[model samples]
Target: MFILGISALYHDSAAALIKDGEIIAAAQEERFTRKKHDLSVPINAIAYCLKEAGIDVGQLDAVAFYDNPILTMERFLDNLVFAAKTDDTDDLMKFSYDSIFGTKLWIHKELEQALGGLGKLGKLLVAEHHISHAASAFYPSPFEDAAVITMDGVGEWATTTIGYGNKEDLKILRQINYPHSIGLLYSAFTYFCGFKVNSGDYKLMGLAPYGKPVYYDLIKERLINIKPDGSYRLNLEYFDYQYGRAMTNEKFAELFGGERRYPESAITKREMDMAASAQKVVEEVLILTAKTAKEITRSKNLVMAGGVALNCVANGKLLKEKIFDNIWIQPAAGDAGGALGCAFYAYYQYYGKKRVIGISDSQKGSYLGPAFSDEEIVKFLSQNEYPYEKFESAEMFYQKISALLQDEKVIGLCQGRMEYGPRALGNRSILGNPRSESMQSQINLKIKYRESFRPFAPSVLKETVLDYFELDGESPYMLFCANVQEHLRKEFSLDSLLDASNMDMLPVVNQARSEIPAVTHVDYSARIQTVDEERNPEYYRILRQLQKDTGYAVIINTSFNVRGEPIVCTPEDAYRCFMRTGMDVLVLNHMILYKEQQPEFVEWEDWRKSYELD
Candidate 1:
């Protein structure tokens, strides 16, 4: 049976198509639209999925939308009815509901029109938002049963949910409602700290180590009440997300004892302290919640998804706590993963398929998206008359790339299948030598143009993970952080960790605190991705070659894109990013193009404007 799943009208919109029990394709709308966190209906992604699967709309046995539109609409109206009487928020409530129903709920009609007016396929079987999130967490996990937790900003009605899944079914045991959301509280702080609400939450998390968690108590007492059972309730008086447009207002600033930090202005000690304090609090609450889930479910394995699950620091803490024997996090833990969620639910929950899940429920190792063939690569280069060289054999290709990385040259490595999640893995990635301490700063500031504090991750060979990190087994998703190994501690100067108790100076020494010091955080931990040959043979081959040459089992791997853009998807996108950035070599399949051989790149003032021109 063919099943098409869609999640849109929310941020990080996406589509996934599954045939039988395997994921045929999955992609986020932002990749095609060239918009970061695009919220529009995933029309482009849907088309891509169908194209990849070589199917038209009529061939699909079922279409599943991520959330129940009627249920969400009911929650929206109910919120409006209560807010109209208590908080004078009728107009804003109407706008929010209207936006969802008007744009997102009507996706079926949009698809029908796109598919040559095929109206019968428009009747999508719907799943609840949290249900989809739970499915996305558990179904692909390498476990027979697992405790599943999904926490995010308001989704239909549930902001947080905890459940347990065994084979084909998931039992949701508890939920936390809206307005009292952990995500909304963090978003409020994100806005107050001069960052975009949903997207900038990570930026705040990354900035945490630069300061102190001094405001933890103050925030707990005044803004949020953390319960013994891991649930939380926000003091609505301090937050304005329920009423007007802005996430935070003057009242929130006064409670925090400052006005909002202005963007592009120098970050101060107070701002860093606030970020650190909030992040610590978030960790504490998430840990408590995870413990609660473990106790209630009594399950040895745990799986998690939702935007909040993207916090690798909290994920690391959960691992260290040893509440569960094993944990699996959806790589696309954000809203984009809702597509996978819906697809899994449609196959298992609705159709009642006798759960014959494979080693990987997703295909190409969750690298289930578009890939350019050697011919396509050549075609694009030849079309543009781009200067390039070609390699006929895999051994020669790996040798050339390894040599470039050994020379500390940044290489754009786009090989094999594109990953389904936010992480680039080895494919659609920018690679550099991790041994150079300055490489981190150079890539962050000069190439990516993102914040220096936003650290990169190491893609280490699975067999050698324990040598460099405190982790065992595979961290394919790059979701959990582990300390640099004890043996390597001296090399990283764990012995001479400088005393910079003054919060203001923390950012200065962040780079000095850990071994694998480039990927390591101030806390001496790294969110690792362990590459296995069974799942990704080509990527494994590359890492093996690098290890034989450099005596290190790891290399720096970050998504191939500049700031304010989605991860590079197409050959054209890869070429543009490579030419514009400090990336020295561009390897699109077998064709290798040097930056100096290419024509000067003219970056579009607006990517959308550039697309329109094409």
Candidate 2:
């Protein structure tokens, strides 16, 4: 059976193709379109998936969308009606009306147009938003039967949902509906701290370790009423997302001192404190929720999907609490993974197909995106008259890259299929020596062209994962953070190195916290991606060779592109990003190109203007 599943008309639009319940190909529309979080129908992504599957549009047995349009329209109507009663939202009503009547009502039409006349022949399946999220979490997981939880800003009427998946039967046991969302509560802090809502939440997470949670008590007293069992309700009077254009209202700003911080402004103590407080609240809520999931479902395993599942800090805390014996998180846990979930929902649940569990997972390491051949890469290099070197064997190639990395030379690596999730994994990643004290600042300022305080993650060999970090098992998708091993950490006071009066974080970010300082955050925690041979053979070999040459197996890994740019999806995209940044080497498949050997590069327009900053 062939199924094409889609998540579109919202952020992170994507398409996934599956054959006989096995994922064949999947890619986000942003990769092809060069737009960050493209919300249109994933036409380009769908075309790529079909071509990769060696099928035409006619071969699709059923096309599934991630959510129901009618249900979504109902939610919008409910919110709009409530807004009219309390706020001056006449203009919002007109915009919301056009947005729903104009686009949400035409999802089927958009799919037909996107598929190029498939409406006449193909069966269209629509799953509830949380059902799509739950299926994505449970079906691809290694667990046979597990408790499932999905939490996000809003999905139709559901904001948070708890479910149980046994064999092919997936049931929604309970739910908390709209306006009382934990995701939105955190997002409100993201907005107030001078960051974009969905795009800037990670920045807030990164900033939390710098400040004390001074407002934890205040937030508990006013903003929310979180119970011992993890259920909570928001103090809606302080938020504006239901009716106003902003995430928070005047009442919210008054609680936090005053005014939302303007974008690109100087960092302050208030933003840091708010970030810390919000993070503490999120962790407490997740731990309590996991306890509830354990008691209700009485399942030893837990699987999670949804935007809130992307909180690695909270994930690590929950893991430490040992709320479940086994835990699995969807790498693309946001809306993009909804495509995978809806497809699984249709195949196993709708078609009544027998379920088969995977040894690790059925996601194929989430490396189901398009990959280019050496021949195609050669053609691009030859056409552009660029210079390069080729390695004949894997042995010499791995050794050569390891040596470059040891000397603190940054490498842009694009190998195999691109990752389907937001994370780079190893295929689309920037490589650097984590032992170098200045490497993090160099990569942040010169390569990524982003903030200085943001920390890098480590791609450590799976065999030596426990040697470097306090992890019980592997973290293949870079979804969790734990403290770097105590012995590897330095006895340094982070505050002693700081200028107490000035709020500049660069001085503090540069302070060495561990033996592998570049990947270590201010709090000594590292977001880790453990490289294993089974899932990522080539990346595994590279890290193994590095360990043989150096005492440590850990190396810095960040996404292959600069800030605001999507991770590179093509050889051309990789090369352009290489030329535009401070990276020293470009590795595409088996070919290696040095920066000094390439032709002089120029862009017609300022490359900085190419992408809108997240």
TM values, all candidates:
0.93, 0.98
Candidate 1 lDDT tens digits, 1-614? 88888888878889998888777899999899998888787889989998998988888888888877777778767767767877778557556856766765676676566554332354777888888889888888877888999988888888888999998988789999887788888888788887788888988887777667989999999988999889989888887777746777688888778899986566667777899888888888888989999999899999999888988888988888888999889888888889988988988978898676566534356788788898898888999899999988878988898898889899888878788778888889998887776778888877887766677789999999999999866788788778888767534332233335333333453455444567776666777899989878888998999988888889899989887778889998899888777788898986789988888777658443433110
Cα lDDT tens digits, model 2, 1-614, are 88888999777999998889889999999999999888889999999999999898888888899998898889887887888787667756756677678987788887887687563246579999999999999998999999999999988888888899998889899889898999999999999999999889999999998877999999999999999989999999999888737899999999999998999998888998999999999999889988999999999999999999999989999999998999999999999999989988998888899888877899899999999999999999999998888999989999999999999999999999999989999999999999999999999999999999899999999889999999988789999999999999997665565556387888777778899999999899999999989889999999999999997899899999999998999999999999999999999998999999998898899999988998
TM-score of 2: 0.98
Best by lDDT: 2
For model 2, how many clashes?
A: 0
Candidate 2 ranges beyond 4 A from true positions: 119-121
- Which ten contiguous residues of candidate 2 have the minimum total lDDT? 114-123
**TM-score (C-alpha) between model 1 and the true structure:** 0.93
